[model samples]
Target: MKKIVYAGLFTFFVSVISFTARAESTVGYFGFEPDIITNYIGPSSKKMGYVRVTIDLMLTDTSDIAVVEHHTPLLRDALVEILSKEPEEKIKSLTGREEIRAKCAE
Candidate 1:
């Protein structure tokens, strides 16, 4: 009976340690570089402005950071393309920003 109890305790301790390590490993944030979209014309069609954006990736795993970084170029290109196509009115509003955020998050 004593030997069984000891084995159980050992198993529990090992499981707790593994759970703690995994929990710790999955906590943090990673920010991508700023992206700028230039030469975009405003409502007036004559006035031009640029849109600058930075994205922060909420990561639950450290390995995800490396994965995100690896695809940074493609991600940047897609985001820039999306931002460049947006009209001045859409880009200037709070809702528009939220919409953009959602799109990027997706």
Candidate 2:
């Protein structure tokens, strides 16, 4: 009985450790090329200021890095289109910027 109990405990511990190691997330940061995105702010009569944005993507698993990099151009174009639609005032405010970012995330 004693031997059986110890063996069961050891097996449980080993399995638990193995499961935890496998379950751990492998995180990676991927930066799209041409890191800086520069575009003129929305409809302004006077000299329109340009907004420069730097975007970096975080992947829960390293495998996603390739997938995201492959779609970089599409991501950039979408972001540019979204920003271009926003008014100059929206780009200037924190809330507005957050809203824009949320939209891009969606």
User: How many residue pairs clash per model?
Assistant: 0, 0
TM-score of 1: 0.68
lDDT of candidates 1 onward, in order: 0.80, 0.81
Give the best candidate by lDDT.
2
Candidate 1: Cα lDDT at 65: 82
How many clashes in candidate 2?
A: 0
Compared with the true structure, what per-residue lDDT tens digits does model 2 show for residues 6-100?
99999999999999998796998987667555566556566567787887878888998888888888888888888777788888999999998
Superposed by TM-score, candidate 1 places the C-alpha of residue 76 at a distance from the truth, in angstroms, of: 0.8
Q: Report the C-alpha lDDT of model 1 over 14-41, residue by residue, as the tens digit.
A: 9999999887776567776554554567
TM-score, one value per model:
0.68, 0.68
